[model samples]
Target: MATLRGSLGEANLGRLVVLREAAGLVTDLVGSEQPVFAWLVHALGSPIVMGGQAQRTLYVADADLVPVGEVPEVRLRMIIEAQNETDFDAALAEAAAIIDVKQIDDKELASLLEKAAEQAFLAHSLALVATPVALREMGFRSMAGSEEALQFKRAHAGVELRIDATADWLANWRLTGISHSARHAQYSEKLLPNEVARGKVFLAVLQIWREAFGNAGMPECLELAVLYERHQASMNRIHVRRPVLTVDPKVFRAILRWMQEQEHKLLDPQGDVTLAFSDGLLRLATGNVAYGCAAWGDWVDDCVVVRQDLLALSGPLARARQIRIEQAADHLGINGLVLHRSPHSIVP
Candidate 1:
């Protein structure tokens, strides 16, 4: 591990300096050991008029070693007269880039550095907010249940959409599960005329948020309304709608049991088993062979013929259940899918 430390400052900005003695300790051990360890700290202090100071640290060690609980070897102190949030962002980006160029080589090390920077930036930004914001104030509230659900409310907001994790919620809405489609006409005939509108709005809201944040975890709910407003125009253009299929609870449960029984045969082949609902039938297919059945009172009618030679189930049965739950959630307008096995329920 080679550590580098330095600082820069401006007249109105507070002075910036590096703890050279500390930095030298880590830099000296760079190529001499099998597992290298480096620690660096950077502090940025602004003038009284610009609000106080913020400190951030970066630490990196070999993946296999237990890290030492000691003070960092290198420390860089910075003071800048940041006029606004943009200035602070620019300064942080520059500092992160400098660290990236100097000591980042391992992928994990780089990720740690990035995470530290993001945390510091978010902390500073949140600190600047004069009034604290709550999720309820932003028209978002969690429902009272074991499963997480979000209720969005706003005047003239079209409809208050309550997104749930379980298939039972869809029953409450009188809607069925559907598959993804590239064309709108494919699933239009199956859904009610009013449902199409509601589903469109629901899906559009989800799509906007998904596109903006991705799987990077939840963002601060305070800014959600602004994000929705910004993306509203574009969301209206989403034409492809997800298909919905109605299934009896007993039938879905039976399918789950059958899947559990054939878990080894379904997963052993290493290819994804795609379960789709269409034409009043639930179909599970992987590779060449396909299976279909219609659910009627806890049992499937017209079960697919199985060729013993072609069936080879492997892997954990829980995985297949998870996939089915996830698919159901996706088609049923549920977000943040979490399948809990102990209670055998899906939570969001």
Candidate 2:
């Protein structure tokens, strides 16, 4: 009852046809002392990837039928049984012949051909599942699923960040979800753990702005509003009017450094700090920071706004827990083959 479908090109169609013919020959030699049957079984069990990067393994359950799905041009319905029963083949041939002789339109002919292709693809899939050796070769092994992941959350200001880790490997972890103020804009994105860590600096920038303006007021200047846009704390969420500002990335970094210094100056009640941008020039009100060029280029010293020590204080997410690999096998059913072990591990 398991049905699968995919595009079948001329090359794959030819392969399927040859495999079908080979199936009959293999079945005939199954009980014999012939080495050919064993070799055919091995060939059948050997994994063939069905799609591109997101490929599925081809399998054979028994000798009777093949499975199928959609194909682009010609639809082929094939039957490779050695027995005399040929009802399905005959029926398809008759339908095709009848359609051919009639004065059907191009669309109608195309529809019939597509239907045939679907059946052919379906037959191809069924034949693989019906082959006996595929299941025999699918021995038990380990796998990890989403349920096996370590899950945790962290809150910065009003944003709640959620992470999931499968193993100690950096690539094995991801920032899976986020929850922020409904009043602020929400973005749908998938981020690696490192990206999530980097996001903290942006979050800190937003925090500085919120502290300066308070929750009731928004920044009036385009410079700070652009910063909000970059930080994903968009002022547009609350219908605040601000000019669209696009500047060189180097200039943006220069502006960020100015903001960081502004935070420090705000700590001093006597310090006068003013921010303004005009004609590709940015200057702080207190005159301590200013950039005259469109490109600020490299920094003279590292402008590390969020200290590494402070970031480490945030700590790791929940420790990953080990679960039985059999769970993954059961989850995938017949679609996937479990190998010796998953190439992943958690430090904890």
Candidate 3:
């Protein structure tokens, strides 16, 4: 990624230069008395009505010059990095989308991103994660890394993600969450070339995130870094609390299948499997741990189907179950009997 130092305003230009230089990015005059590199703040750092590819979108910020000739009052700060120049170019375009946002630190920028993501997901019923460039355009400064997923919850959100509260908010907002936390951390580590063993350690800790969140385990440094990297790549290196809905039936089931394929290290040693169900009505609930969190989905049909699959399961446990599975309609409510083994059968 390329870091573009944009300085503006008559108030401060020296601080901007100093911060950029401190960041180890600088350019010199190629042979002219005036340096092309410092033109942003050199002549007189003032908020110019400058424009970019998008008309009237980019406005240089008000700035002040410091004693050390650095621009201290940098109204806007940003970080840019990309896998390649093409990625960087694509990112710049994304940044152009909201170039009008005023100066904001990474945290506020992250909140905006989470809100925007929540809105987008709600509007589309999809899980939409904000890209680094998207965050930058929203006035979020990048700290480090490129693939970090920013984390934060809506300030308006009454509940945190991963709990039933968060899930309920997503439903209320008509949004879907793409739970890439564990999966992304795992995928990111596998992409590393050297230190294969070390990479495994990274995933190992990430695998325990649920346990960590539940107050049962602690994540290691590699896991922390992986999450940190995600945050760094996010708006201002922050986490966005984006409300997301479940993936499509196919994808949701696949996610569960992938989880099931993994060893049961993430779950409590006592965690067991059973039928799951949900409606607008919350009658009986099985905590996430009880259902193994794998093979369980949130869609009413999927849950009812899975519930039936569990009830019909051919085992000693199946005969000894107590949860109610309704297959027929009654005066009370519509009930589903079959707990589906996989999500596909519920739809087709």
Model 1, which residues run further than 4 Å from truth?
1-224, 228-276, 283-310, 318-320, 324-348
**Of 2 and 3, the candidate ranking higher by lDDT:** 2
Q: Which candidate is the best by lDDT?
A: 1
Q: Could you tell me which 10 consecutive residues in candidate 1 have the lowest summed lDDT?
A: 185-194
* Candidate 2 accuracy as TM-score: 0.17
| lDDT (0 to 1) per candidate | 0.34, 0.32, 0.29
Model 3, position 275: C-alpha lDDT score: 32
Per-residue error for 208 in candidate 2, Å, reads 50
Question: Sorted on lDDT, highest at the top, how do the candidates line up?
Answer: 1, 2, 3
Per-residue lDDT tens digits for candidate 3, residues 237-288, read 4663322122133333433444354425544322223333443222222224
Tell me, what's the RMSD of every candidate?
Answer: 19.6, 26.8, 21.4
Residue 165, candidate 2: alpha-carbon lDDT: 30
Model 3 misplaced stretches (Cα beyond 4 Å): 1-85, 101-110, 114-217, 220-324, 327-348
User: What is the TM-score of each predicted model, taking all chains together?
Assistant: 0.24, 0.17, 0.18
lDDT of 2: 0.32
